[model samples]
Target chain A: MKKAVPLYIGTAALCMVGFAYTLYQIFYVAPLAQAPLYYNQKIFYYHVPCAFMLFAAVITCGIASIKYLRKREERWDDVAFAAAEVAVMFGLIVLVTGVLWAKPAWDKWWVWDARLTSALLLWMTMLAYMLVRKYGGAGAERLAAGLGIFAMINIPLVYASTRLWKTNHPSANTVPSLDSSMRAALWLSVLLFTFFFILLLRLRIDAQRAERRLYRCREMALDAGLFE
Target chain B: MDFLQHVKTLAWKDIRVEFRSREIVYTMTFFAGMVVLLFSFAFLRESSAANGGMITDASLSPGFIWVAVLFSGTLGLSRTFDRERETGTMRGLLLSPMPRAAIFLGKAVGIFVMVLVVQAVVLPLVALFFDAPLFDHPLALLCLTLAGTLGFALVGSVFAAMLLKSGSREVLLPVVLYPILVPLFIAAIKGTATMMSGSMSETWFWIRFLLAYDLIFTVAALWTFEHLVIE
Candidate 1:
C-alpha cells in the first residue's frame, strides 16, 4: 500500500498532463475540418474517448460478473462493482458531452436517433444494475452479476434494433477521412482516457476490498464478544 | 430428453393451476383490455379532434397495441413468480432434482401462453375500438406478436425470478425489465406498423430482428437462470 501511493499519484499526474495536451490539440492542433461546426466538434475528443471507456468498463463488468458467478469470490465481485460504477460515470460524461455536441451539430438538445437512444438506454440499464446492487436483498451480489451479464448482452441488440428502426445519427461507417493531425490527437486522447480509466478502477477496487475487510472484522469482533 | 420432459411437466403444472384458478389469464386479459380502452380514448380524441380520419387510427393502432401488451404482459410476469412465492412452492420446486433452467423455461412458457391469450383478446378489441385495419396481414401480425411475446416472456421470467425474493419486486421488475426490452419493443412496433400499412417488404427486417433478440435472450436467460435462482 505504501509503495502504490506514488504509482497512483504518478498516474494521476500523467492523466492531468494528457488532459491538458488533449485540450490544446482540440483547440489549436487539430484542423477545423467541418465548417460552421469547428469549435463544437471539439467535444468529440472528450466525448468519443468517454464513450470508448464506457464500453470498456461495461465489458470488464460483464467478464468480472461471470467470474464472480462461477467462483463466488469477493474479489471478482469487487471488480465487477468497481467496473459498473466507473461505467456509469463514463456513461454520464458521454451523454452530457453528447448532448452538448448534439445541440450544436443538430440544432437540438436531444434526438431519438439510434445511437443516442441506445446510449441512453445503456446508461439506464447500468443505473438499474447499480440500483439492484444497492437495494436487492440477501443475494444482491449474485442478482447484480446476472444483471451485469444481461446488460452486456443487450448492448449489441440495442444497437442493431436502433439502427434497423432508424438512422438519423451519424454512422461511424461513413465517417469522412480525418486529417493526420486530427487522427493523432484522437488516438492520443483515447490512450489518455484508457490510462485514467485503469487508475480509477484500481482505486475503486481497493476501496471495495478495504470495506469488505472492515465488514468481516466487525463480524469477527461481534462473534468474539468484543463489543458487548 | 429428461430436461425437456421436466420443462413440459413444470409448464403443465403452471398451466393447470392457472386454468383452475383462472386468476392470471382473467386478470391479464382484463388489464390488457383496459389498457386498449384507455389508449383508444386518448388516441381517438387526439385523432378525431385533429382530422377524424380512419388513416390516423390505422397508423397509430400498431404502437398502441404493443404498448398495451407490454404493460399487461409485465403485470402477468410479476404474477408468474408471485404464485410460486405465495404458495411457498418455489423452494419445493427448487429442491426438486431437476435442473433450474427447466424451471425458467417452464415459467417462461406459461407467461408466453398467457401473454398470447391476452394479445388474442386485446388485438381484436384494439381493432374494433380504433376501427383500424389490423387484419390486413393476419399471418404477418400473428408471427410478429408471437416473436415479440416470446422475447418479452424470456427476459421477464428471468427477471421476475431474480426479483422474487426482493422486497420491492413489483416496482423493480418493470424498472429493470423495460429498458432492456427497448430493442424488442422497437422491433415489434416497427413490424406491426409495416404490416398495418399493407407492405410486407420492410416487415421482414423487424421480424428477423425480433427472432434474433428472442434467441439471444433465451440462451442468456437459460445460462444465467441457475445462478439467479440459487440461494
Candidate 2:
C-alpha cells in the first residue's frame, strides 16, 4: 500500500495535465474547419477516449470473469465486479457525450445508426450484467461471470449485424487526416484516460476487497460469541 | 450410456412428461395466439380502419410473427426447469452420472420442439388473420424458423436453468435474453422479410448470420452449461 501511493499520485497528476492540455488544444490549437459544428466535434477527443475506456473495462471484466469461473477466487470476482462498474460508468459517458455530439452534428439527439445502436445495446448488456450480479442470489458471481463472458462474445456479433443492417453513422475512413497537433492531442487524451481507468479500477478492486474482508471478519466475530 | 443416447433419453423424457401433462404446449400455444390476436387488433384494425396498407403487407408480418414467437417462447423457456425444480428432480438429475452437456442439450431440444409446435399453430393463425403470404417461400421460411428457434432455445435454456433459483425468473429471463439475442433477432427479421417479399438474393446472408449465431451460442452453451448448473 505504501509503495502504491506515489504511482497513484503520479497518474492523477498526469491525467490533470493531459486534460488541461486537451482542452487548450481543442479550443485554440485545432482548426475549426467544420463550421457551426466545430465545438461539437471537440467532444470527439473526450468521447472517443471514453468509448475506448468502456471497451477496455468490459474486456477486463470478461477476462476477470473467466478467471473467477476457473479458480473461484474472490479476488477475480472483485476485479470483475470493479471492471463492470467502471465499464458502466464509461458507457454512460460515451452515450451522453455521443448524444451531445449528435445533437449538434446530426440535428437530432438519437439515430438508429449502427455504431450508436450497438453502443446502446452494449450499455444495456452491461446494465443487465450488473442486475444479475445484484439480484442473482447464492451463486450470483457465477451467473454474472457467465453473463460477462456472453456479453463479450456478443459484442462482435452486435458490431457485425449493425454494419450489415444499416450504417447512417460515419464510415470507417470518414475521419479526415487530423492535423499533427490534433493527432498528438488525441493520443495524449487516450493515454491519460487509460491511466485514469487503471487508477479507478485499482481503487475499486481494493475497496471491494476491503468490504469482503470486513464481512468475513464480522461473520467470524459473530461466531465467536461477540455482540450481535 | 453413449452421449447421444443420454441426450435422447433426457429429451424424450421431457417430451413424454410434457405430452402427458399437456400444460406447456396448451399454454404456450394459447399465449402465442393471444399475442397474434392482440397485434391484429392493435395494428391490423387501426390500419384497415384508416385504409393503410401497412398491416396487411408482407413486410410487416415478419416482425409481427417473430414478436409473437419471441414472447411465447419466453413462456416455455422459463417453464423448462420449473418441473424439475418443483418435483425435486433437479437434484437427482444433477447427481446422475450423465454428462452435464447432455442435460443442457436435452432441455434445449425439448424447448425447441415445444416452440416449433407453438409456431406451427401460430404461423397458420398468422396467415389466416393477417393474410400473410407465408406459403410463397415455404421452405425458406421453415429453414429460417428452425434456425431462429434453435438459437433461441439454446441460449434460453442455459439462462433459464441458471436463473431457476432466482425469485424473478420470468422478468429476468427476457431482460437478459433479449439483449443477447438482438443480432439473431435482426437476422431472423431481415431473413423472413426478404423471403416474404419473394426475394432470394440477400436472404442467404441473413440465413448465414443466423446459422453463425446458432453455431457460436450452441458451442458456448454446451461448454458453459456444466459450470452454470452445478452448485
Candidate 3:
C-alpha cells in the first residue's frame, strides 16, 4: 500500500497535464477556428472523453459484479461499490460539460436529444446504484452488485436511441470532421482522462476497504465481548 | 425435464398467488387510469377536440401516456418483488434447482402480462378522454405497446430481483428503472404517435425502431438476469 502511493501520484500528474491540454484545445484553438459553431463543438474533446471514462467505470462495475456473484467475495463487492460511486461523479462532469456546450451551441440549457437524455439516464442509474448501496442495509452488497449489472445492461440502448429515432436532437452524423491537430489533442485528452479515472478508482477502493476493515474489527470485538 | 418442471412450477405458483389477491393488477390499472385522467384534465381543459387528433399542440398524447405507464410500471415492479421478500418464499425458490433466469423470466412474464392488460385499458381510455383516435393503427400500436411493456418488465424484473431483499426495494427499483427505460419510452411514444396520427406510411420506420429497442434490451436483460437473481 505504501509503494502504491507513488503510482497514484504519477497518474494524477499525467492526468493534470491532459486536463490542461483539453482545456487549451477547448478554450484556445477551438475559438481561433473560422466558424463559431465549431467553438462550442470543441467542448466535445473534454466532454466525450469524460463520457468514455464514465463508461469505463461502469464496465468495471459490471466486471466486479460478475466476480462478486461468482465468488461471493467481499473484496469484489467493495471494488464494485467504489467504482460505481466514482462513475457517478464522472457522469455528472460529463453532464455539466455537455450542458455548458449545449447552452452556447444550441442556445438551450438542455435538450431532450437522445445523447443528452441517455447521459441523464446513465446518471440516474449510477445514482440509483449508489442509493441502493447506501440505504439498502447489510444485504445490499448482493443487491447492489445485481443493480450494477442491470444498469450496465442499459448503456447500449441509451447510446443507440438517437440513430434509431428521428428526433430534434442532433444525430451522430452531425459530429464535425476533425483536423489533424484537433484529432491529436482529442486523443491525448481521452488517454489522460483514462488515467485520472484509474487513479480515482484506486483511491476510492482503498478508502472503502479501510472502512470495511474497521467495520469487521468492531464486529469481532463486540462478538468477543470486548466492550462489555 | 426437471428444470422445465421447476420453471413451470415457479411460474404457476406466482400466477396462482396473483389470482388469489389480484393486488398488483388492481393497483397498476387504477393508478394508470388516474394518471391519464389527471393529465387530460390539466392538459386539455375540455373534450371538444377530444374526438379528433386534438391535443397535437404539445407532445401531448403519447408523452402523457408513457409517463403514466412508466410510473405505474414501477409500482407494479415493486409489488411483485416485495411479495417474494415479505413472505421469505424467494429464498426457497432460489435454493431450488431451477435456473435463476427461469425465476427472473417467470417474474418478467407475469409483470408484462399484467402491464399489458393495464395498457389495453389505458390506451382506449386515453383515446376516449383525449379523443386521439388510437385504434386507427391498431397493429402498430399493439407492437409498440408490447415492445415497451416487455422492455419495462424485463429490466424491471432484473431490478426487482436485485432489490428484493433490500430495505428500500420499493423506492430503489423505479429510481434505477426510469432513466434506463427512456429510450423505450421515446420509441414507443414516437411509434404510437405516428400510428395514431394516421401517418401509416412512415409508421413502419418508427415501428422498426421500437422493435430494435425491444430486441437490444431484451437480450441485455437476459444476459444480466442470472447474475441479479442468483444472489
Candidate 4:
C-alpha cells in the first residue's frame, strides 16, 4: 500500500489535467446546443458522465455488498462503503448539474419527469444506506450490507420505471444522434470520469483498510495493558 | 412438512398473543383510520359544502388508502418484534429448532395479517371519508393490497429484525424501509387509482407489478434472514 502512493499521486495529476482539458473542450470545441438551450446546455457533457459514474458506483457497491454478506469479509465491506460514498458524490453532481441545466432550458429547477425521478430515487437509497451505516449502532455494517443487497434488487425496478412511464427528459436515443464534436467531448468526459472514480475508490479503500488496522492494533494493545 | 408446521406454529403464536390482547390490532386500526381522516381534513374544502362536504380533491383519493397503509404499516412493523425483544424471547427463538427462514416467514405472515385487518377498517373509513368507491372493484383492490402488504411485511420484517437490537430502530426503520419500498407504493397507489377509475384492464398491469415486487423481495427476505437476524 505504501508503494502505491506515487502511483496515486500520478493518477491524481492525470485526473487534474484530464478535467482541465475536458472543461476546455466543453467551452471552445463542442458545437452550440440547439436553439433554446444555447450555452447553458454545456452542463450535459459533465452531467451525463457523472450520471454514468453514479450508476457504475452503485453497481460496484451492490456487488461488493453481496460479496461481503456471502463471505463476511471486511475488505468487501470496505470496497462497498467506498463505492457507495463515490456514488453519493456523483449522484449529487448529476442532480445539481441536471437542475442547473433545467433552469436555463426547461425554465424550472425541477420537473417530475420519469428520468429525473428515477435518478432521485436511486440517490435517496444511496443516502439512506449512509444513514444506516452512521446511526444503526453496533451491527450497522451488517445492516448496511443487507440494504446494499436490497438496493441492488430495486435497481431493475428503477430502470424499468422510466421506460414504463412517460418521460419529459431527453430520451435514451438522444446520445446516439449527438453531433460528432459534442460526442467526442462527451466520450472524453466519460473516460476521464471513469478513471477519476476508480482512483478515488482505490484511495478510499486503502484509507479504510489502514484505519481498520490501526483500530485492531489499538485493541490488541489495550488487551495487553500496553499503557502500563 | 415439518418446516411448514414450524412456520405455522410460529405464526400462530404471534396471532394468538396479539388477538388476545387486541392491542396491536386496535391501535393500528385506529392509527390507520386517523391517517385517512386527517388527509380528508387537509384536502376537503368547505366551499364544496353545497354538495354536503363532498371530497373536492378526488385525484388523491387513491393515494389516501395507501398513505394510510404505509404510515400505519410502518407503525405496526416497528412493534411486531417488540414482544420478543422485551422478554428476551428472541434468544429462545434463535435457539429453537425452527430454521431461520421459518422465523422470518412466520413473523412476516403475522404482520401481513395485522395489516390486512387494519385495512379492513381503514378501507371503509377511507371510502366514507375520501368519497372514493374503493369497494366497487373489491377483487382488484384485494389483490393489490395483498401484494403490497406482503412485500411491505417481508422487507419490513428483515430490517426490523436487523434493527431489533439497535438503539434507534423506530426512526431508522422508515428511513431504511421507505426508499426500498417506494416502487411498491407507486405500483399499489397507481393500481388502486386505475381500479377506481373503472379501467379494469389497466389495473391488472399494476397488480402484476405489485406481485412481481412481492415475489422478488420474498426471496430476498428469506435469503437475508439467516444472515441478518443471527445474534
The DockQ scores of all candidates, in the order shown, are 0.73, 0.70, 0.55, 0.75
For model 1, the superposed segments whose C-alpha errors exceed 4 Å read A173-176, B45-56
lDDT of 4: 0.88
Residue-level lDDT tens digits of model 3 in B30-78: 9999998788768754324547443433347888788888888888888
Model 2 Cα lDDT, one tens digit per residue, B90-120: 8888899998998889999999999999989
* Superposed Cα deviation of residue A46, candidate 1 (Å): 0.7
What is the clash count for each candidate, in the order shown? 0, 0, 1, 0
Provide the DockQ value for model 2: 0.70
Report the lDDT tens digits of candidate 3 across residue range A1-228: 789998988888887776886787767664344555556677678788888888888989988987898888988988898889888998999999988988867788887776777778877888888887789866677777766776676677676665554456555553346566677677778888877888888999899888988999999999999988
Per prediction, fnat is 0.60, 0.49, 0.64, 0.68
Candidates sorted by DockQ, best first: 4, 1, 2, 3
Model with the higher TM-score, candidate 2 or 4: 4
TM-score of 1: 0.95
Report the lDDT tens digits of candidate 2 across residue range A1-228.
668879888988988888888899877887764776876777888988898999899889989988888888999999999999999999999999999988878889998877887788888988998898887777878888888888888899988887865566767554447777677667778888999999999989989988988999999999998957
Interface RMSD of each: 1.0, 1.1, 2.3, 1.2
Clashing residue pairs for model 1 = none
Each prediction's TM-score versus the true structure: 0.95, 0.95, 0.86, 0.97
lDDT of each: 0.87, 0.85, 0.77, 0.88
Over 4 Å off, model 3: A17-31, A37-45, A165-176, B1-8, B45-59, B200-226
Tell me, by DockQ, which candidate is best. 4
Question: Over the stretch B1-231, how does candidate 1's per-residue lDDT look in tens digits?
Answer: 999999999989988989998898999899888887777667554444565543336678888888888999999998878888999999999998988989899889999999999999988987888777788888888889999999999999999999999988788888789988989998899898888887798788788889999999999998888888854
lDDT measured at residue B61 in model 4 versus the true structure, 0 to 100: 78
